[model samples]
Target: MAGCTGATSERTAAAVHGLPEDALLDMGDFAGAVLKYLRRHPVDRLTIAGGFAKLSKLAAGHLDLHSGRSQVDPRHLAALAREAGAGEDLAGAVAAAGTGLEALRLCAAGGVALGDRVAEAARATALGVLRGAPVTVDVLCVDRAGVVVGRAAPAGPPERGTAGGAARQD
Candidate 1:
């Protein structure tokens, strides 16, 4: 014979289901209400500035671009750079990537050591532009907070600082 279910258990399950259903229910305009609440509550906001170059540290070890004859992996490059203290320029470059996640990926791929390597790579490309190598590369510079301070393509002229410093003649 089949066992009969108890009404108490059925009621309990129904009650449990009703409580969590709120998550599934759509709360139209709830975000506006929350924003209003926060506005009234007065929470402090912090501004963080960083570039794609630094954030790329997260994935720097995975990149294998421009490797030939036992090329250093991105992670190895990053680790080495970390040991050698090569974060700043790379971070600046990553910050210059125009987006947060892209910067992070570059950081991860270039690794710490790879930061200098990438910067070197960028410098080499810049130098090639100087030498009329005919290869096109874009150079971007950012401050420590990841804010883009400069961008230059191999074919374009250098940018001027906010105070109108003399433009780089090269």
Candidate 2:
């Protein structure tokens, strides 16, 4: 697992899961970091742990996963909320939410698993990178307090999005 403790990290999850992390999961390039770790150590499965901001970039298929390189577009998040069964009002709230975590909370309060959707999207992106490498990927969306708010196991969704038109570069 990888993700925080510092401002750009949620290393609590990494510590809990016992991942050897040496860089910030946010700006170090999340997918790149995972692949780099794989090149050395061997692991059967992979877990990506982070909050909404980090995961949102992954969900949007941003390999860089940095604020400057890729940003969390509330409109895309709102669309995901709608796809997750959030009503118009709640979706609008997500669009205007102050922070990514706040938007996630709004979706959760409205009984929508926005983070799950995001995790699944991120997993799909990772699988694309893996390219049938026989490794399964799981993504966890953790809140700042180190609570697991959402998850997407490899066996969960068949595929959330592809490395195609579904992913938004912006």
Model 1 residue 95 distance off true place after TM-score fit, in angstroms: 18
Q: Write the per-residue lDDT of candidate 1 for residues 30-83, one digit (tens) a residue.
A: 212222333344222211111323312212321212223122234433343444
Instruction: Provide the lDDT at 154 for model 1.
Output: 29
lDDT to native, each model? 0.31, 0.67
lDDT of 2 at 57: 78
What lDDT is reached at residue 151 by model 1?
A: 32
lDDT of 2 at 49: 68
Query: Per-prediction TM-score, please?
Result: 0.21, 0.73
- Candidate 2 per-residue C-alpha lDDT over 40-124 given as tens digits, one digit per residue, 9 for 90 to 100: 5535666676666777877777766767777887887898889889999999999998788889989888899998988777777
**Model 2 off-target regions past 4 Å?**
1-27, 36-42, 156-170
